[model samples]
Target: MDREAKKEAFRKYLESSGVLDALTKVLVSLYEESDKPSAAVEFIKQKLGGPSLSEHEKLQAEKMDLQRKYDELLAAHRDACKELEELRNLKHEGDVKEMVDNNDAKEM
Candidate 1:
């Protein structure tokens, strides 16, 4: 309910979830860097396992390309299935007609 209590609860949550440990390790790595990055926030972000903007963009492009290929393959599969069904129907009609003709010839 009070500010100190809230702070203690937040600290406990971070420790229990291992956020404190992970952040400490990342900070230690940044401290040990001989050539410190100009963008310290971005460096910390990357060290915290977040993707950089360029990597995120590249992934998005790759996802879009894969989706396009998937759509093309799906369309081709549907077209092939439709053609197969039409051929099956045509063959069935031909077989029925041939049987009827044979019956008529036998009757004659």
Candidate 2:
């Protein structure tokens, strides 16, 4: 039933007074074992219960963070490629020195 009735029934049952709580207790204890008994499955089921939008929100937040990181890394990689192309086209010592300086700045 509800909380108060269930509690009173449990206490009375522990007091060895009646037989109504027998089926309920047995059913609760054996709930997961009727057809598909699994401790892991029950644990996961319990974890997913109870107003649980947080798990979905957490996954979305993680996806956003990963997307942001991916965009940053992609931009850095493209810039690195462009700099590498410029360095390849360098024609003199001064040009090589400038490219090396720019590369060092990028590393910093």
Candidate 3:
């Protein structure tokens, strides 16, 4: 494509994808800053790195918390199952012992 066509295409892409609006808002925020940053890059970074970054961090923390809870619950379930199996084994042994005792009593 030619230079004019490429420029038009880039502008259209920026406008259609909301990049233009985001840049405009960032620039406006930088202009309104009481304590202006020394560097333009820093100003842009500060304005652009707004709520989205914090929201992502908050979501990560919540995910970690949920994962920890899930792990604890899984461990507890496994422990309970192990205990149940032990109880079952003990009950089976007691039944066998009772049968043997009854047979000996009958013989006597």
Candidate 4:
């Protein structure tokens, strides 16, 4: 079928949609007058990619930022684990008892 026939069929389909009556009228009018207003939303989204970051690009950036944050956190956690292991090895056997005794003396 031709573009006009397709536009007429779309108009018929859109008649059942009360929510989009104004949009349907506008698009149908445009479609009848010209070949425009027939492009689907996905087509427009695909066409508008990345002059200043489309929605998909923005989401990918956000995901990368989150992954970087997670990697930083993991690095910090590993450093903390290494430091904790070093502190454990450096601690004298009686150090905990000395601290407990000092705190008890302070309380008294």
Candidate lDDT values, in order: 0.96, 0.70, 0.89, 0.71
Which ten residues in a row are the worst by lDDT in model 3? 45-54
The number of the candidate with the highest TM-score is 1
lDDT of 1 by residue, 1-108 (tens): 999999999999999999999999999999999999998888889999998878889999999999999999999999999999999999999999999999999999
What ranges in model 2 sit over 4 Å off? 1-52, 91-108
What lDDT is reached at residue 78 by model 4?
A: 100
| Candidate 2 CA-lDDT value | 0.70
Ranking by TM-score: 1, 3, 4, 2
- Residue 85 displacement in candidate 3 (angstroms): 0.4
Candidate 2's residue-wise lDDT over 1-108, tens digit each? 999999998888766853445545545656655564555444444443422346668888999999999999999999999998887777566788989999999999
**For residues 6-91, could you state the per-residue lDDT of candidate 4 as single tens digits?**
99888777787653675655556555754453445543444434232366788889999999999999999999999998888668
Instruction: Answer with 1 or 3, whichever has the higher lDDT.
Output: 1
C-alpha TM-scores of all predictions:
0.89, 0.39, 0.54, 0.42
Best by lDDT: 1
Quick one: RMSD of model 3? 4.7
Model 3 agreement with the true structure over 1-108: per-residue lDDT tens digits: 999999999999999999999999999988898987778775686667654555768999999999999999999999999999999999999999999999999999
Task: Pick the winner on lDDT between candidates 3 and 4.
Answer: 3
- Kindly indicate the candidate among 1 and 4 with the higher TM-score: 1
